[model samples]
Target chain A: MKKDRHFYWRLFSSTFTLSAFTFGGGYVIVPLMQKRFVKELKWIEEDEMLDLVAIGQSAPGPIAINTSILVGYRMAGIPGALLTVTGTVLPPLIVITIISYFYIAFRDNHLVKALFKGMQAGVAAVIVDVVIEMAARIIRNRRLLAIIVMALSFIAAVLLKINIVIILLFCGILGAYTTLRSKHDARSSPDSGKDESCAEGSGTGGSAGKKEGSD
Target chain B: MIYLQLFWSFFLVGLFSFGGGYASLPLIQEQVLKINSWLTPAEFMDILTISQMTPGPIAINASTFVGTKVAGLPGAVIATAGCVTPSCIIVLTLAVLYYRFKGLDMVQGIIKGLRPAVVALIASAGYSILLTVLFDSDDYTFRLSDLDFIAAGLFAVSLFLLRKFKLNPIYAMLAAGIVGMVIYGFLPSF
Candidate 1:
């Protein structure tokens, strides 16, 4: 009983501290998470760290929150997920609440205005940087389909101004179709691919918390 | 009354805010500025600045700021809860089910498709933020004369620093603010 309580407390406090102190959003928090969980605590493996980041980024909402939940769930379960997520969001809720009270004062301040306008330009640049980095990673895969989808999606978003939700749905369907077709072709090939079912089975099953780059 | 609205609005923001928190800004702008008039354009910009300055994700920061502005302490709680709930639910469900279906070719394909789309969404989001900084919209039209060249130059310099020197974004943002203060606040440039 005592161990369980201690574990939960540690989980909450570590996540809370990480979220509270980290600046620059999700990307920044990721490395900190690696340090705390993989290095300091030894709770998760290095590769699992990457998987958590991948799943977190791919899912909805904030990557920080998603990662916290995943890490928590990986360690414990639903309760851990709840605890970590609460810890992750608490600092921002507190900080922004205080700022809201001072909103009028800050709004009318000349220095703050100039600072924010300048920061906005910097923020624009950061977003551009994010785009370049993400594109470069995708390009490394050398998948023509991925590249084509990325370009088309960019056009639809930037030029045509299509709705974002619709675009995601369309791409998801296309991806599933292409992948499924390719898998079918491989299975039907005369080579028949020995150990295919073994590979598929091992891929699906949880490996005693030792999952490492199944993809 | 307002609390419920805040929750519902942020709930929608959470649900559709894929890619990242930055991608959620348009949804936020639409709900808070256009649909409800909870904040004016200038106030919206302030929220954006605060969101960036703060530690959490922009979505959480924005929701908290807007909620507090709209209702108060309880408003902040409800709004943040709403914004975060969808993610929690979605992630928890996936955490349970994803590995179970991990080997399904269709599943991998769906994720593969979503990856490029997410990249596009992120790029589009950056473009939107850049649009606000680079161009001045007056009477619903962009004017070349209204373009702020100084801000554009700062943006280029910041991007260069980030890519070339691998500078942390916080420092880049701070440097840009300092430059802005020097030019707009002290230099007496029009």
Candidate 2:
């Protein structure tokens, strides 16, 4: 019973390094993981990377953490996912343990204060940069819809203090609707010379965006 | 007892976090602010700033910082472990079942629905944090004078240089920090 565990090892190694070295939290991890796992290693393809990001963002947990889980599971199995997540999480855990011992001693140091103050500005910049990258992807697909949803939600949260969960649900519904409708339109077109009209929205087979790479 | 509480609570957060850690911000905030009383809301923001400066998950950082604050080094260890243990458990379990569900229609349908919601959550997180940044302070006053306009002008220039021109964010951040310190030193109350 031989198993190909190299994929798992690679994922674990990459995710672990990513977790350890990442600065400014989860936002920084996404693109780094993308560059390493997708471009450097070629373990996952480009479109798949996009989809992976979408799912990782849409679900719960840390991006690197959940990504390791999903990608690990895909590559090997439950054990693989476990290994990958641990590999990623363990380094930071250890580093933080060490930092905890010494943070108090240097807590009031001028350089440390300056570093943190700089990071406050950098952290926001990083978040915005990542958001722009993601928004670029969505905008490429459906510019108007993406802008509308983004602007509307931005306004709602900024002005009305709407809940995040509620905003997410609304966007998810709208995205699905548009995606499904586009698929339906594609199928119903006379290009294939098929006269079939999608009668039931739920059971119709034209769900074009269901592909792993597309999601 | 505190360890157990942290473990159970974060385990639940891990299970329900469907889109990633940002989605769990509100939940984590509730636990830390309302239920646990480990850190005041203001303190939590400070921890956030610290966490962003360092490596690792925000939740994990929060856990460690709060735990240390509350119960020392031991508490930090417990909290950090508690924060991550759930994903370890869940991700491992799901890895086994990945193939069976990979091509499923229902799963895709559900995910198709989940995507936009995730976007909304991200946007909302940004917004929620913005409110906290802008309005949560005691002296939350805005003056529309020329000096203020100069600060705004600098902010815009920085935003564009960092965003459009692709200047390094770390540099931009450091520059802003320097500008902040300088402005404070000079104007004091401008």
Candidate 3:
């Protein structure tokens, strides 16, 4: 019983400290979590960590939170999941709350305004880089369907100004349909070469490309 | 009532915010700026900036910040909870199924389909932010004379550094802010 309590404490603190210190968001925190749990603690295997990250990415919502839930659950079940989530969230909740209180004061400062103006430009550039890299990956995969969906979605968003949720729903349904159809086709034509009807399941899509060429 | 609205808005953001941090920008924009006028365009940009600069996920930071702005500490708590609730539930369910089946072809297919669309959403969001920074307006219409060349130059240079040097985005943002302070704050550019 005592050992179990100590383990829970360690789990919470590790996640809490990681969440508190990591500044680059989900992409940054995820690897750190792997190092701590897989490398440092030796609690989870390297392959298992990779699988957790894949599951985390595939699920909706922030990758950090999703990852935390999975890791915590794997380690200790529902209580551990609850504890790790609270630990993961508390840092940002506290930090942002403090900042929000002083935000009005900061907002009116001339120097602060100029600084934010500069950051806005940088933020824009980063976003553009993300779009380009992500789009490039899809294009490089040589999947016609993926490329067409990407182009159409971009046009829909920029020109037509369609609601984003609707676009996501349409693409998801289309993806599932293509996969199901392709599977069916492959079953009937047993001698057929690898089916290319569905986009390759490069589960590391969009934001997951962060560490691609950086090394 | 306002608290409830904030929860629901962020809940939708959590639900549909696929891909990752930047992809959530449009969903949050839809909620905070379009459906509800809780924040003006400038305020929205500032919140995003703060979110990017801080730790944790941008989605959580933005939700907490917006919640506080709209209501108070309670609002922040509620908004943060709403943002994370979907993640916990969905991930837990997925974890269970994953251990059982070991193969999630259907989920994989859906994610494959969502990938390009998520990229498009991020692009659209970036375009809007670019418009606001360069043209000082979010609308489609802007005069050439109204363009901010300095910000555009910063954007180009930042993009080059990020792509070529693989500079950390936090450092890039900080450098840009320092340059902003030098030119806009101290220099006689006004």
Predicted structure with the largest TM-score when compared to the true one: 3
DockQ of each: 0.60, 0.32, 0.58
lDDT of each: 0.79, 0.59, 0.85
RMSD of each: 4.0, 7.0, 6.0
Clashes of 2: 13
Interface RMSD of 2: 5.8
lDDT accuracy of residue B50 in candidate 1? 71
Put down candidate 1 lDDT per residue, B25-139, tens digits, no spaces: 6567657865798986657766776777788998899899888888888999999999999989988777776555543345456777888887877776566567678884311
Residues A14-77, candidate 3, lDDT per residue (tens digit)? 9999999988587889999999998998777676678889999999998888899988887777
User: Candidate 1 vs candidate 3: which has greater lDDT?
Assistant: 3
What lDDT score is found at residue B128 in candidate 2? 40
1 or 3: which has the higher DockQ? Answer: 1
Candidate 2 lDDT over A24-107, as tens digits, reads 566678888789877897656665555555555544567767776766655455666677777776766666656656766775
Ranking by DockQ: 1, 3, 2
Candidate 2 wrongly placed segments (more than 4 Å): A1-15, A25-58, A70-77, A100-115, A125-215, B8-37, B40-42, B73-78, B81-97, B104-117, B131-157, B181-190
Q: lDDT of candidate 3?
A: 0.85
Docking class of 1: medium
TM-score, model 3 to reference: 0.91
iRMS, all models:
2.7, 5.8, 4.3
TM-score of chain B, per candidate?
0.81, 0.71, 0.94
